[model samples]
Target: MKARTRTNLWFQLALVLTLGTLMAWGPAVPVQAQDVVVKVGNIIPLSGPSASVGLQGKQAREMAVEEINAAGGIQSLGGAKLVMLYADSESKPEKGVAEAERLINTEKVHVLTGCWNSAVTYPVTAVAERYGIPFIVPVSVADKITEQGFKNVFRIAAKDSWWTRDQFAFLKDLQEEFGTKVSKLAFVYENGDWGKGFAEQWKKLAAEQGYEVVLDEPYPSTATDLSPVVQKIRRARPDVLMLVSNAADAILLTNTLAEYKVNLKAVITSGGGHADPSFLKAAGENARYLFDIVEWETDINKPGAQEANAKYKAKYGQNLTGEAVDAYLAMYVLADALERAGSLDPAKIREALAATNYRSGPGMIVGYDAVEFDETGQNEHASLVMVQINDLGQGLERITVWPKGARRAGYTPVFPMPAR
Candidate 1:
């Protein structure tokens, strides 16, 4: 009886030891499986004239979401992964509104981001307001976008007026460096919200800058041949030619310049045409020496830029463009805001978005360095960059950083024409 009792005691002790060891080192306690999903909605032009821009943005947003998920997602949100739902706005206002509604109502997305065109952005913003969803504008440059005073809407991109002011400053620098006077300048723009808005801002800034506007013309977006307009510009012979159009129209005008040999000292393009890679591909040698106002630069290769480039190429088999960078950074901003807000509630996200501050690609720490918004929700510290279309026609070299006296000062005219 004593031997049996001793044996039983030994077996119980060994079993207890084994169980305790298993409890200590076994399978991580299964981690209570977090919800692990943060939903984001996108509205962009997927099939219209701006399709390429929209496509780039879509790919970048997706890439950012994937990367966030791979890194275990928002650490502050219990490791919740991001899920994105995209809607095609087709560059139309009504479609944008419908898509915005669908994204908020059907998909139940926690956040909204995208809409390449400002016109599309404006309508979609109304939907976001109605649904109480937080909308972040990535590439739309319309000045009134944030000026609408929608609390839920935040813009990470610079407004048109901001770009106009920066471009004028660069022009002044160009004039001073080259001694090439731009007393009379011609502004040509397409008949869209973006074009119209830029033209008005350009006129306002030109007046303030003491430049004479020789010609201010608005053409239909679908205008195929720019020969007539080119002839008109040639007749006026403005010292500088400023073009505001998409890639296609830009190409048309460039062709006209090549065909007619319009005598202009300097040609500048709005951010829309200049920032797109397709313009270089389409215009080739004609694109050389042209200047553009750009928001993002791939060559700048600041912190997080190379990683973004490589990841973007790996996923899309192409390099990042301004459109792609904007969307990618926008996603990062959204993620940061969500994580900081600690909840997917749209209102909280809006508050957090207003408070967003993080380092993004191209060496820019967005929402940092004084990202306070005015009563109009416009980011007061927004800045712009001047980029020159180089001889290679493949990339835009940074000319200057805006608001003056930054680390990278404005450019001196490298190929300034002799004064007439």
Candidate 2:
């Protein structure tokens, strides 16, 4: 045979061998379309006032799902990938309920999560319970959410009552640490289930601590101008101001407080708005010396936390907030349950979630050690860390400063925030 013909024959033999090897490898593991898809319905305030945090939660979930899928997905289900289907609650309880109904009946999502507003989550829980769908709440801290006697609802964050309890404990510690007395207390919050819930506990705790409640103010979260509320806080003459606000209002309240020069020993804020990624930038100097309670902060001592935050910041153009962290971890928690359940049945998934004691993983970057759920479907290990917003010579950042042990090393908390 000619040289060209011999060369052609050799190439054909090699091509045949390659094709045989590929066939023996079992069809190249199939395409994504052939893999099982686990649909997770996420209901959140994608519009209106809570949009910023809602967007953060969405981004976090997407990142986690992408990672989970990239890491071979759910092995037991033939490498099933999680598919997130989102519905906007618009911060309305009715809208949340309606969206929950649509996501369940129409989208046929196996698991449900979110509706960040506690009011929305409160009612959405019933809908999930009625449908026998497991609803994993990432950061909605309403006690009523887990207290509703529903087997399908689980919360991954400390409840509002727990938050309030910690707030007062921190206050006691604050007074002892600095040798400063905090006599008068003020409660300012959004007039919603979440804010009202926190305020109710604050009142009881204040009374128990023998601290006089100087002001109890609840304002609309949609209020464009918070000067009136700031004026009330200024006039209340409280030593410390406790706040529970969403993102927009959190910024508005902080700016207004600074603009009006509200004098107070310190400002303690719940994590929602105060923990927002954009809060420091939007509030600027006004957010300084503010103490906020959260489940996770950028300065946490956990392993992999800084790396995760760095990766997230590179992807999302902002550091991970507590809300973002919870949402991110919720995806991992759900992925864990799905892995163990080994089935798509909601009942099996629910059983797996109820028994979860997730200890270590990329998602375990939270301050807590584990993600164990109590009988009430609350993560017993879920706890809050108090972070002070200050410039540690690096612009403004949240520095963990509570529980004493977890406090950032070599950083002294500024109490009785200096006057502007």
Candidate 3:
């Protein structure tokens, strides 16, 4: 009887102490709201020859993510916050595939984006498909990337083929308005999938436009010495030069062109090195008056684009490039999908993406007429504008000169590049 009483007394004392502690603590504080985090993974060449393109894209998306979070995140999922994950592929296709796999399997990101350059995006997007992750392409424009008919892969920029027809129009305008007499046209590009498309399209267009193909050249992307190629260009004496190159090759060839003083009636380029800020900076005064077809230009006078330019300049201390503008829009596309999905299910996100008609929202910042994806997962209404670098010193400022509807006042395309 005495042992039982001692155990009962200890229990009574424990209960009394618990009550006293509760009384001292007062009313309980309500549970703090938990943040629902959505993870997005991106793989790009951050340290290779194309690193500038990747880094520029990275900064643009970071700016968008910050804006999204500041605006209270995704309201559909109780203020779900987005987290960004990035991996560098060093501009290698195999490395891009490996990094994309890591992002999907290890990091378990809900959506995947990036893998610039068509060479890298092809394999990396294939991985995203096998894992059933939604992938939005911001840079790579290889037609085959979307032609594979993968539902999970969607592209927000104009395809390579889509821009070719516009090029014909641009050329016509050049001849009629700028008095550039076109007879012989030389086509040159790096030997890769993207360059192949550029070359093929230029060949077809030149034939249709009644211009002789004087010189067609395909050089290695890693060709550091382009003096021989420049010599060939000098010998060909084409009336026009159509160069489709990435940034590094563009710099190399530009140097060669300057060295040999290879002058043509006009020079036109499709993206890559010719349309990039790094190329302009490296080429310096030589980059002036070159016609470059671009996805987006800082000087495009549009509602959302003008506003974005101001904000982008304030944030990055520089104007937004085509790659950066596309990337900025890409993040918004993912966020819009997440908000509409209302759940982390990849299938639902894909469905949301298919049904997307983000015309009036953040998707408009890139001035894409429509954000809706077609059956082939390509944006049906991606905006395209051409710009010419006007300033030739340390910094390059490319002003929109083509697509008269998008050009700003006081911006004129300098045609028939002045002889060096």
Best by lDDT: 2
Cα RMSD (angstroms) for every candidate in the order listed: 11.7, 12.0, 9.3
lDDT of 2: 0.90
Off by over 4 Å in 1: 1-33, 45-51, 90-95, 173-199, 214-239, 244-265, 271-287, 295-297, 359-373, 392-415, 418-420
Model 3 TM-score? 0.70
Q: Order the candidates by lDDT, highest first — what do you get?
A: 2, 3, 1
Candidate 2 lDDT, tens digit per residue, 316-403? Answer: 8998987899999999999999999988789999999999989889897776678989988999988788889999788998898886
- Alpha carbon lDDT of each predicted model: 0.75, 0.90, 0.83
- Whose lDDT is higher: candidate 1's or candidate 3's? 3
- Candidate 1: C-alpha RMSD to true structure equals 11.7
lDDT of 1 at 49: 91
